[model samples]
Target: MSTNLTSETAAPTRVALVTGGSGGIGRAVVERLARDGFALGVHYSGNKAKADETVAAIVAGGGRAIAIGGDVAEERDMSAAFDAVEAEFGGIDVVVNTAGIMILSPIATMDLDELDRMLRTNVRGTFVVSQQAARRVRSGGAIVNFSTSVTRTQFPSYGGYVASKAAVESMTLILARELRGKDVTVNAVAPGPTATPLFLTGKDDVAIAGLAQAVPLQRLGQPTDIAETVAFLAGSARWINGQVIFTNGGLA
Candidate 1:
């Protein structure tokens, strides 16, 4: 009898490892990818509870997910995290670098220490995770990084945060060029005035409303808004590589 190879036997499940998967936008990306039918690695920095919660929700929705935690800026931590996902999910097809920190201060008045802290997380963390992803992500996969729309807006008090993400944008573009012929796409998503815990932490109602009004769409971006762009980049958008997509609602 001839052996019949079904499509299931020929193709394995696609896998995604999302850094900061427990946070607002990160969780949305994780859930969106899970619904897109990829097995997920929900990575957290220190909050295992949130990580586990994300995983549980994915599971409840009949999706496959596992919690992985580590400092994204540490090469060793990220290496181990990648190892764990590979062991659990076979291979990673997409690596999403959504783990980052933001500290707002005017350049002249900002504390250097706070700037350093933001850089360590936003820049070093991205570099470390990208290093692992460059080495590990399977062919025909994608590596998505995060930048910020403030880079374009030139907003005050965002000097530190914008500097870090500027590095990310530069690095992302170079990496995409370097990955040429690898069949792996690399890009960064720049979101503006998103209503996340990170964005809403210090801003009062007036400041928030002003930001929303600045957008031509007249609303603060939801996590899902950013996640939709990510979902497109991660699963399809084969032609859209080496570019930063501004996910803001016409913030200029």
Candidate 2:
């Protein structure tokens, strides 16, 4: 089962498919992986304009990229995304599942519909994407899924969100173990209070400042900060598998 394709013996360029690549952290990951010499398939659910912008930026920088559209929670959509990337790049090497949504509410008072949406997008979405990655990614590749530091912080009003991410963490560990000696590493990155639109929207300056000060670093995380960790896991951090790397600036 050991089909490890190290750089020394494999093709010159690796290929990566990043879900939610039109968004904040996903865009950063797409750019970082492109710069890391990966041919990229940037997948977005909605907003082709944004996805195109991300791809354009990469091509402008002389990096290879393509924009693919699909709903991550849908198996057919995600499967097609993988197929497109494989068709273009000849093979898939890395898969980064960054497509997720957060709707905060106390479990006691939460809207069941919202909870279901979060579960479908965050939990089921990761499951569907990971299934494709496990089946298609070449040896020596890695799968990086997005979780959240809130899973550890256990904050109030985050019950639904935390539950979804907890499922992600569990699935990530199980997938890594299932891969066995396939030479593919599976892991999750849980970031805290990143300064993405998803985090900043609807929050006042005071709330944002409070979140920033809560971190030991005294500032919210930037997309690039999380991208660096993703790049490590997607590229060279082969020994680091089946674990959640918390990039929360000591917030947890």
Candidate 3:
């Protein structure tokens, strides 16, 4: 048997729904899972074009994929997204939530509006999606949520962002325990300074370089690097549950 796993190598019946799948780490996870032979639901918030393009590429690669659009914080939107995926692919076996925002601001001086926006999408979004997943995902399924290494790094100006992700971590842990006897493993991947647009948008070259050097591995992480962990948790690593896996390159 060939070592390479592509859409052709495994059963296409197992399905995955990825939130924020249009770009950044979400895109990488979609591509990786397609290679692993899972028919995918690519969930986008606002940019349907990017989601459509992602679906087109996967389909072009002989993989099964579709784009789903929704506001992760809205129950109706997320419920509809889940319904669409289940309708198209039969059932959902794995859900990877990589949708998040990083707005840097000091806790003391942060605007209430900015804090509300961050909490709405990050905290409430995870809750809404997880609620749907908990009720809808089939047996032997897994749930992987995104977190940040900053929760441990305690970086300045990340109070709001970290606070939001901290909520994600709490939920991931409790959900794992809550899903007992259901054969669903829930976990969170906490990444450090990945090179996605989310991390690079406002930083200068110097700021970026310094962050890369801080990692003991001496380089910034790629979206693929984080996706690799997600795919593992989704497909294998059955015993790893109710914990935070720091996907950072030894950057503690």
**Candidate 1 structure quality by residue, lDDT tens digits, 78-142:** 99999999999899999999999888888899999888888999999999999999999999999
Tens-digit lDDT string for candidate 3 (103-192): 997889999899999899999999999999999889999999989999999999999999999999999999999999999999999999
**lDDT, model 1, position 21:** 97
CA RMSD of all predictions: 2.2, 4.3, 3.2
Reference-based lDDT, each prediction:
0.94, 0.94, 0.94
Q: Backbone collision count in every prediction?
A: 0, 0, 0
- Model 2 quality (TM-score): 0.95
Can you tell me which runs of candidate 1 are displaced by over 4 Å? 1-10
- Superposed on all Cα atoms, model 3 deviates from the true structure by an RMSD in Å of 3.2
- Choose 1 or 2, whichever is better by TM-score: 1
The TM-score values for the models, in the order shown, are: 0.96, 0.95, 0.95
Q: Is candidate 1 or candidate 3 better by TM-score?
A: 1
Instruction: Give the winner by TM-score.
Output: 1
Whole-structure CA lDDT of model 2: 0.94
Q: Give one digit per residue, the lDDT tens place, for model 2 in 1-252.
A: 779997788866899999999889999999999888999999999899999999999999999999999999999999899999989889999999999998878889999999999999999999999999999999899999999999888988889999999999999999999999899999999999999998988789998999999999999999999999999999779899999999999996
Of candidate 3, the 10-residue stretch with the lowest lDDT total is 4-13
